[model samples]
Every structure is written in structure tokens, then in C-alpha cells.
Target: MHDITHRNRAESPSSKTLFKATAIALVVGAGLLVTTVLPAEYGIDPTGVGGYLGLTQLNAIAPQETAEPVEDPMISDAQLASLLNPVWKSSAPLRNDTLTITLGPNEGAEIKAQMQEGDRFMFKWEAQGPVNFDMHGERPNAGDEFTSYWTGRNKTNANGAFQAPFEGVHGWYWHNGGAQPVTVTVTTTGFYEKLYKL
Candidate 1:
């Protein structure tokens, strides 16, 4: 209460006094920045005072980065190849093809690729809408005889790799049961003779 009476009557500091305090503060700050902060934080010692004060040793307590690989050690070419793609030997020539088909409501279509036995292939198919599909292969010289590998109902997409068991025409048969037309786009890359719509 007694100090509150002089709140409005307080004598403001003179410019000269303010300047002197600011100069002292600035000098102390610069000295600390050069001697303590730089050395302790970044191991950068401009003045030797920081090293003598053990502040520079504080920077060494932190971890140091290295160029060495942690998870990746020196590996053989076979190991590197397996890590990349792990290619399996196939007798069939490498062939890649993209096939697209549009099916109306209650309509079904078959897309097939001719491959020999033991021939491998990777296929991915995407449908604009839900569909029923059967991934199967037909045996050579067999009429209406087939082997079912995979089947799904109401699937939008599929990704798989197949090794022909006893190859003739291996492929997918997609049926659209929806009201609207669905466009199915399939991409295949592997050891197959050719891709065509049946």
C-alpha cells in the first residue's frame, strides 16, 4: 500500500543508465555464447575457457553419427538378387501383356494366357466394380475339363503369381452381377506364350 502511492510518481531510469546496463548484458551474453554455449552444444570452442570448464566435454557425451550401414552388411550377389526380385528360372520366354474387358450386368468373360507346364507368371487384375472370378487352368487336349486354383465372389482386385501345374490355357473368368457395366483391366508379366480374350 505504501509503494502503491508512488507508482505514478516513480522516477524513470535515465537513458545513460539504461545504455550502460544494456552494454554490460550484451558483453556478458557474447562472452557466454563464445565460451560456453558454442562449446557445450555444438563442440565449437572459440575461446579455450569452455574446454577448461569441461563444457566442451559435454558435447562428446552425445552420440556420433557414422557412415556404416546398420541393417545392410556386405552380401553376395545371389543374396542381393534374392532381396531384390528373387527370380526363378523358367523355360518359357518372358512375356508381358495388358488386357482389358468390359462386362455388362449378368455377363461373364474369360481372359487366358497359353503357358506350358512349370511356367510361372505374375498377374494383377482390377475391376471398376465388384465381380465374381475364377482363376483356373485347362488341361491340354481336355474339353471342358479344368483345374480351379482360386475363386472369389464380389472381389474388386486380385494379385497373385501362378506356376502352371499342367498347362493348357490358364486364366481368369470374371462375371459381373451388378446392374452397371464393369471394366476389368488385367496386367500380366511372366513366362507365358500369349494373352488373349476367350
Candidate 2:
């Protein structure tokens, strides 16, 4: 038979000690929330420590500039019609052309269509291997000046439509960069006068 009343009971921490521990925990949690969580999450730097640590920039918004609007000059209907008309009128019938050319390693070639401003055509081309290409145009008397519409590198195929911006030659230039030969085949249809190799 054991004397149960004489046994020692488990002791609890003093009220003062418990209160001190809880206060310390609350202080540490509040400090962490103010210094780290606020600045990093919301860009709110209250104590300046977040700014010193560069955490305030995490949510910073960039400054933006306001652009001034410009007004366009209106043109008369007759002027607009004159500007939209084609430079040359062809009495001959339209034609379609397909061209295939082989380019040696590091070699280049070009093909042009005789087109007037507002003339349009659909074109598609493919290379047997990867190549670089540029679609551009030039006026006959413009003295070496040219306008580039698009350019691409390391491509195998492309298809698109184009409307001439001036009375000129519009076309594509392809450059083969591989060690082996590459063949480029192009098919076009529309109002162009002719397709010729350049």
C-alpha cells in the first residue's frame, strides 16, 4: 500500500516567468512582422531598416511618363484618291511565277517582282536547309536606297502577303550559311508585272 498523499505533484512555471516569456515572444513576433513581413510583402518600410536592406524595392512601382497626343492634318477626298492610285497601269494580263535556285555555302541570291504602289501579292518560300532572308524593296531611280519589310535568320520556310509601298522592285534575298548547298523554292501570285532573278 503506497501513501499517495505524500507523493510530490508536478510544478508549473511561476506566473511572473510565464508572463515574461509570453511578452518576449510577442515582442519578437511584432518586430519580425514590422521589419521583414511588411516591407518585403507590401513595400511598406516603417523603420527604414527595410530600405537599408533593399527589401523595400521588392514591391516598388516604377515612375511613368505621360505622352502628349499629336493631331493629324486632314486631306480632301480628291487628294486621298490621288495618293491611293497605282503609279503604273498595266494593260497586260497578270501572271504567276515559281522560281527555284540553289545557293552554295555562304552564297546569296535575290528575286524581285516588278510592282507598283498598292499592288499586292501572296508569296511562299522554303529552303531545303536553314538560311537567312530579307524581304525588301527599292526604287529604280532611288540610287541604292532600299526599304526593308522583314528579315529573319535560321529559317526553313515562310509564307505571307505583301502590298507594294512604292513603284519599285520588291523581293527577297536569301543567304545560305551551311556547309552544304541549300535550295530555295518560291511561289507567288498577284498583280506583279514580272518575277526576275537579281
Q: Give the best candidate by lDDT.
A: 1
The C-alpha local distance difference test score for the whole of candidate 2 amounts to 0.89
Q: List, residue by residue over 25-137, the lDDT tens digit for candidate 2.
A: 99999998889889988988899888888888887866577776547567878888899884656553477889999999999999999987888888999999999999999
Q: What TM-score would every model get versus the actual structure? A: 0.56, 0.55
Candidate 1: C-alpha lDDT: 0.92
Model 2 backbone overlap count: 0
Local lDDT at 93 for model 2: 49
**Residue-pair clashes per candidate:** 0, 0
TM-score of 2: 0.55
CA lDDT, every model vs. true structure = 0.92, 0.89
> Candidate 2: misplaced stretches above 4 Å?
1-92
Superposed model 1: Cα runs more than 4 Å off: 1-87
Residues 10-54, candidate 1: write the lDDT tens digits.
477778889999999999999989999999999999889889999
